[model samples]
Target: MLMFSEDKGKVKFNKPLYGMTGKYTLAEGISLPYFSSLLDIDRAINELRIAEQVPASLEAKWSLKELFQREIDEKRVRQDIVKGYLLDPKKLKFFNAITIVLMPKGADDKILDSFENDSTIPPPTIPWEGNDVEDGQWNHPNARIANFGGVQFISIGLSARLRWDENRVLAVAVDGQHRLSALRTFREDQEFGRSGSLRTHEQETKIPVLFVLLHPDAGFLNVSVQANYSIRRISRELFTDLNKNAKTVDKARELILDDKSINAQCVRTLLTESTTEDIPGLLPLSLVRWQDDFNRFDTSYYLNSLVHLNLLVSEILELKDKELRDPMDKKQVMGFIKSINDALGINGQEVKDGERPLTRYYLEDCCEDEEDPHTPFSRLPEHYLDSAVEGFIVNFRPWLLRLLLDFKPYQELLAYARQYNLIEGNFGKFQAQTSKHKNAILQQENTKDSEWNKREILIPQSAINSMKENQWAFKAIFQKAMIRLGRIIGFEVRSENKNLGNIDDFLNFLNGLYDKGILRVDASLPDHSYRLWTFIALNPGNEKIKVNRAVEDRIFSLLRLWYFGTRKIQIDTAAGEQILSNRKLLQFFAADKNRVHWPGCPEAYETLRKGFDVATLYRKDSNEITIEEKKELVRVRFSAVLAAGLPVLSQLQRGALHEQSSEYYNQDNES
Candidate 1:
């Protein structure tokens, strides 16, 4: 028991708290015990002010936000300590230890130097007096020690004298702020105060702490910081050096998980503990601190990569405080996680068997030395993993989904057109020709088996999986696809002319097109078309590509519908699933790239003329054919065009296509 005397300014302890005992000598004349006690915590909260506040003159030198942000997140700190009790009471225990520094006010420079450097110097006189004046006396008025038989308490001061007084702040907090803040806030909250668990123990609660006594010289203010550095569990520089559940990491995670949005939920799941029932976590259950961990060379790459992806999603959906109740939105958001897992080859079986997961592979591969297993991702020579993540989110995920989803309304329109027997000509022949033209370009680029290579009407699985192997290739394909669609659709897509960094800003630009009547939104998938057109037109995937025409690959497979039908086009349901898998249309595009514009070239009209000529032979009335008859002609004619390998529309025809779609383009561009 450590005892504090109210009248005489003395402290006496019979034994260390929790029966732990250790001590260190500062100077030849002075030494302090490694003490832990309930009284220390109570005294720290009531008596201590941070070192920056002490000595008054040093206050201006320390920035409040920069120096003490640990104190600002009080709610998170409170949740951390009480969360164990709240979630499972049986696991509750003292979360962390408080560390305090005893620095007396205005000590002599020489004496302070001796303590600071761990050099020996003679002891000063004691300030405390016992019942017999000669029996207990030690240092100057700034410090003192009193002994009752074998037990002793050393009082090193932050105030003028080694005394306990309300007017003087006595100690400086070196560590364990989260724990202290939680304890203080729990007592203050009326509800928490009434809680039986906290009230049950009261002052009987004991925590372990390490304390250091420093000389009260201005230079020794840094000594408090030194004490903080000495703690072995925290390594502020390298993330790999951090303990599994560091206080800082825990606090950040709790703060993020507190949100309830679907977007946040997805992020929460990624940062949650890996389980056999769910996907393996890309991030640790307890996240690293952004402020400290971000600046560390070891942790910054992966931390920012994950955080930036979350930011991208949140920005697109406006996820803050917004719950996604719409089935479509929910499906899409959840699918985003599933796509990532599939792309990364994440399997629950592998995780349950204790196999190294995909996320760990990338992180480990990037490290400088494979032999040093402790610092898992401490030395990434190049940030390839981060680039891969960015590429997946920006290029493959959104772009692929756009092609699949935007076709919904078109499919509905095509079905309506088919039912009424109002179809004209062999537009299907024109669509197949368009697919050939696009696939030729992809093949030219040496990208075998790509969406373009297969003449895909939907996003391909190869496109999604390729992101892992070559993010740059995916980036190139994405940029090229966008510019091609923009030009083919007659939109003078100027990447440089847009505010293209934020996903939301780019989406707004697409909505402006809808507002202008150049494009239409399938009310069921509101942001689909906006995402599709802008994703390519704005070239949002690759930041390295300047918004220019040079990167555009003239492979506009998405333009097939415009030449084939004025209505929205629909593909077979079986094909849609085989192509899109779990991907949602919102993840891809809102409307068909074909719906926005027609290729204005003479070559396009020429091809349509041939299709019309073929359909004319099958018409009931010379000018038109029924849906069934039109389909038969289209299938036969388009197969012939594909086999014959005729040019669909060359770049030479680009000028003509631009002229044709110019009116539609201008309507939306101006709006």
Candidate 2:
């Protein structure tokens, strides 16, 4: 509907002379099919989506002027600076075109000459201030990390150069287009010693992209059934609430039917009477599909499964007792599930990611077609663990994911995962790559709004040693929250490894430092802070998890702040007191003592001891979890290292500097 340049000219392309280029493809061939209607359009779009067949013979002379609102003040009185920025392409440098020899599917060498004669005066470079470095420097870590391995680029041909009002815009390849465009444009322009704008700057930037060519009417970034990116905008609080619906449902399930509830005996008869397994809260989260089908799985399905899974698991723990851990860890269960499934080989897709597990981070990587069993998912009991459900969790995920190519469902699933605290590979590692790593497809092109949705990941306590020594009091105060959130273990994080590696890697040293008031780790605010953050991103909510980063930064910052070699007090507090302060010291003591919030009433604790209806909510399952609070709090009071293990820490610190040389023994990537 919108177009800027409609110029039609007799622009004659140079002849394909064998003498001029040593290659001869004079055989005339026509190859352009604008797919029409429902089926044919889909087919045509599908074929052209991947293929780049711009033949010399089929030269449709497009002399249309590549137009733009050159001067910002022209025609449209773009007084609203925000609107101008959101719609500005010249400012964003999102415009790019790939000129490549299009290779046919499964074909090599004999690539069809695509974009052979498509060169125009204005090159397809992202116009950043017409010449600024920041234009291409947008951080899209979730986008393709690299295409064809190392090169952060992708294949994009001249599909369609549609017009938007006064701007020339691209219309196809929604995902990875930015990255591809950046690469193509950078590769096209390079001078000696002078780095031709190959990469973008560091800080993340976002521009509102309007779909001008794809759907002329599609003005906003509306999500489609095909390639959805961001989920509908939900507040961070609401997102957490929506995700925690499972918890609410789970609570209702227990209250209505659990033996500990008021209707202990008669609730079963009142509910289903079928062993009371179909309680509301009990649900397996795997029912959620990876595709945006109308029949999307909800918390209801998850609740249903939990009703049964909980009943079975609770009974199993009572029966198998000690084997089942105090904390219901997925990794342990996954190992158990895999041991049973080792015999029955998984069908469908098999990615050769050598060491990683075969589950989606959500565990839907192997989801299968819904099967009607004798009972609902909530009523299946633990028998499924030895039967089809076991096979489904272990085998079906990979099978189902192979076919769901539509990117939206995956995005939604990931969005949901981040909304809730369910990170870890339940579905498979592929899900992690898809949802968290954000490095799947690297380049500015592959960037999306969902990429920024991950607010932060909670930092693990094991890595707390990496945070600066000045922050120890802070870290100590926050250790309780970290342990509760699985970010830390009270005394030891790496129980087996002990002090075998770098002093930093050793949980004892990490804990000792914290106890000695050296590392200052940030404490998560509340549900509001953790709302949209997944474990992939370590913000304030995950500062503890990225303690290594904090530590690394502190060491370097010290070097810059003070001339090096002058201070021998790497662990000493007096010399390094420039950064630390009395206010933080007070906060540390307050946090360490669990006095951040006034401990007015012991109602929750007393209620638990008295065994009230919601007693379990505030109760600690074990002493190991409860008794270590004081130890962790008092331990991190900072003190200078007396030079015992300084040499080893220095070496480990150096290795960390080189992006390798980890404390973990024999890690493949350790420098």
Candidate 3:
């Protein structure tokens, strides 16, 4: 066991720990030799009375000494560090040398003997020198001594002080006591094997220690605290990957150096330089739970979510076919960033950091009174049209592409209808907030101009222009299209209770729908039963059965006019704020639990294509007929068509049930 020398002021060693060893002075009164070796740390555990705490009820004489009397559980030390080391000796290479502070009980001048020059061994290399060295500086050079001791005591830098006479503790461990205890336990065969004698013939292991001598001075106690607590250590995350130089900062630097994309560059800029008054990376950094060492060149406190953000951006740029969008070059991606920033009202003048993007930008001031039809979301709330943006795109992109693929003929037909007023509704007045003249239609001389000045054409300019001119029209059109699509296939999307009002209320309602499995829009098709619209695209290879793109666009345009322009159903009203009490009118399109169908049922579409005017089913003006009178007319005209498809639907439902039964029986037999 390592212990104090016979002199009590110096550290004693039975044999040389490493090939070279000597003693040297550090600062004015401290000095010790430093070397690296395997240490039996278990033999060096020391508990010293370091501090005290007194309760309010006790007198002031209780003193502060009781604070340091708290004992460390040695078993915890063995389990955490020692057992792992014995199992794999390779783990022993990481710990620094143990520190021992020796305070001789009485004033011992002989302790300074080691601080003096030793003629027997070569002089030690001290780390620091000159007047810069203060008394408390741990790395200060050793002061020269006048006496020469026969025994060689080498001090490279590690040292401890000893307090004699006052306490028989003799020596105290300032650091690494757990390591010492674990070493002791392993040595005593309390670890590794059942018999514990498997490693009895092991080679001698030595631990390098620094020894300092002090004469029980108050200054020495302060020095012990300073020695143990002052030095800053690397973070655990950085320390584990030290061999590969893998640190948070390093990863950030790599992204800046290799990835020159605008988004990546923005991330780099946020980490490296403060572009705004506040730290640009603060919000992102706050989300990070780990960081690299402070001394690392690329030590970033904030780049933890950089990877997730980049991945999201990448996905947003992909085409419906899962291919990289040909139009999404660097310039296009930058444009998208600017557009998103504009939509969120995030001015690029200052990059806000350390905030949740969704909460800060999207959810602010969105919820409002549903009774008011004047308000609209500040940004285009397309995501609110569906619960999941990914699912929304998946369902709509194919449908949209099929429509846009042959849009020229559809546009001409719309132009013809507008010019002649042949459609059911009049597009003669403007009800949008953007327009000054309430009664005049906003006519664009350059009708083909791009809406946002971006070079992309996913949908027709005429359609986009109409929607932008009146956002209320867009919401009405979107619902009509959804209902029409649902009718063509046999699925019903809207529920009576789920009818919500306005954009914000609808967003909340969609969230509820998602929870109730009503709007379970996910990527997996086989697991989803609500995606009846997808079946149109899944039609078997028969070209005759497949719906044509021009036909689809015509139907979509027809429904938009039939609902928004003719029926004049305000966005909030259709959203379910004030329930449309026309149950007879709704039953003509929307399906109940038993019979599933929507507005654009194929038979209904055939009826409309044969030049049937939908305005004939409902009252256009109160002067002509009352709501109840129109409801009677609608019920009479659509009762037969509503019941016509029941036989086909029943046949399909029966076949599906039989297939499900067969699959379950097969699985049960196999099990």
Candidate 4:
């Protein structure tokens, strides 16, 4: 008999189990022993189950394959582990604890009876004199078992050994699946004599394992009855939570899961509550890719990725890099306010030297830490962090949404998608379709079948290709450019700057640009004389538009000049002055061959001339000059400027611009 006991009372058992067991408290205040043990590599590979192979239980109607565990990469198992770790057994090889959930295969009526009766069974005591106990339980002098508060408690010392019967429980991995897979591969290869240099002793190595047992009262073990909480759902939730908290997880996943980062939390709120009545989210989840951090939006159906969206949110809220990475703090809040004031050109009362600056913006109440002035900004109190996150979301959400929706291209795209039934009005169907599309793509990739590919085609291929060509409006660079411009406009609106126009005026200006084809991929002059996009911001020959700081700044400057003209809003900054005064524009046209013959050049010059007082081509030095002389002078200056800005010939066009000057230079060099 195994002789399992409860509170000094011995109870005989048919099967014996072993491990070092102790209580661990969960979020719901349910305490259970997370059993820890070391198992031989062979036994672990055979006995333990991954999510993909978990057997069905009466409590769970569906399979555990729906868990968020990533599929194991065979190549990684072969190269990084089998070839790297096991091949070098001489070096110290260690593995982290593989977390597993030990779920009962079926309901034990006795345990259910104990829970139903609300039993308070006393702890069992073991006689000190025995080596007569079960083989593994002999060393556990202090081990005791009891049933209280609808949970069975098995208390034992850290060094004590308790038996684990693999037949009675289903052990499914909640974390470290990849490591387990790699070990299984290594074992298989060793058996087949394919493991190059792994020794026989290495195959007998033991790995650390942690077995989590949920409280019996949580209803996870009551397999006979249907309930809200089940082993499948709980285990899946645990898997997701574990990976989401791990440092090795990707940033995009972190943004979706991180509660500590205010920026990330705000992003989640925007995505989840996008269609809510209180907060109308303009950027639907269907239009945003929340998976990988790659910025190749031009090729995908998504307009933006989560990483860039987080960055945009951070920028819009004026969050510092440190704040984005860490928790928001009072010091960071102060800094953010300072930045806001600077953006709006709000110069508060000047402070004297050697004194703290004036608090121009309202500061939220927070407990002050006087002990350490340089305490980490992330260490702010919980209440303060909560207040900060809530305040930011409430204040900035409307502005951010309006800014995104006000952009002409975004509005047009939304309307078009809605018209084609590609997106739902309330976004409910769109989200479901997005999830279906993602799953279909995954299935297609995994199966390598064209049938799966058909299911994955949510959007028409022709439409996708057209969107790719017209991706200029949806590119990250373009979105960021709009955000930067919107930031200025938002500040002007909030500060009630006189030069700031109403929403209608802003809309009209954007619509005018759209109508002129300036925002299109093929934006150019009427006769295809010159590419207007090239003259403005885009590189001459690039296919995909990338994030270029210089290019973005140029775009902002040009838009500000054209939209606001030479008013105070346009010429307030040095950059604005340079563009509006025609100095920078003239220099740009004179230097860049691509801009001299641009159709907008003359209009731009005329705008500058009207905005600022400047001399014409004719000099006022000689009054004796005739009207024809003035005309000749004007023509000569125009011809010289045009000639200076002419494009240089390519190697293919080498003899295309043949000139006598070039021939004379050649003859002089030969002589």
Q: Judged by TM-score relative to the true structure, which candidate is superior, 1 or 2?
A: 1
Q: All candidates' TM-scores?
A: 0.36, 0.16, 0.25, 0.46
Cα lDDT of model 3 by residue, 469-556, tens digit: 3111112223233334332321123233232222233333323322333222121222332222122222222312233543444435
Relative to the unseen true structure, what is the C-alpha lDDT of residue 413 in candidate 4, on a scale of 0 to 100? 58
lDDT of 2 by residue, 127-180 (tens): 212444543332233322111100112111211111111111112222223233
Q: Write the per-residue lDDT of candidate 4 for residues 35-127, one digit (tens) a residue.
A: 777876766776676655554342254434566456666655655565545555443678899998755542331112112222343322333
What is the number of backbone collisions in each predicted candidate, taken in the order shown?
23, 69, 48, 15
The most accurate candidate by TM-score is 4
- What is the lDDT for 400 in model 4? 60
Q: Please write out the lDDT profile of model 1 over residues 1-671, one tens digit for every residue.
A: 23333332322222122223345555553334444444444444445454334454433433323333333354355443543243334444555666664432223211011222212321222323344343233344644443221223344442212232222113445566556656655655664654423454555665555544333222123333454432112212112222224555433343364332333343443332421111222332212222221211112111122343344344333322233232224343334323334332222221111344434543354223533322222111122233324333433344323321232322333243333322221222222234576556556644654444343322222322322232221233332343334332322222332211222333333333334333321111121222223222233333223333322322233223232221111232324533221011111222234223322322332333233344233535744666555544433333222211112222123233223223332332332
List ranges where model 4 is wrong by over 4 Å: 1-247, 272-281, 321-374, 379-381, 424-468, 492-495, 525-530, 541-546, 566-671
Sliding window of 10 residues with minimal summed lDDT for model 3: 230-239
Q: Write down the worst ten-residue block by lDDT for model 4.
A: 109-118
* Prediction 2 global C-alpha lDDT: 0.25
Whole-structure CA lDDT of model 3: 0.31
Best by lDDT: 4
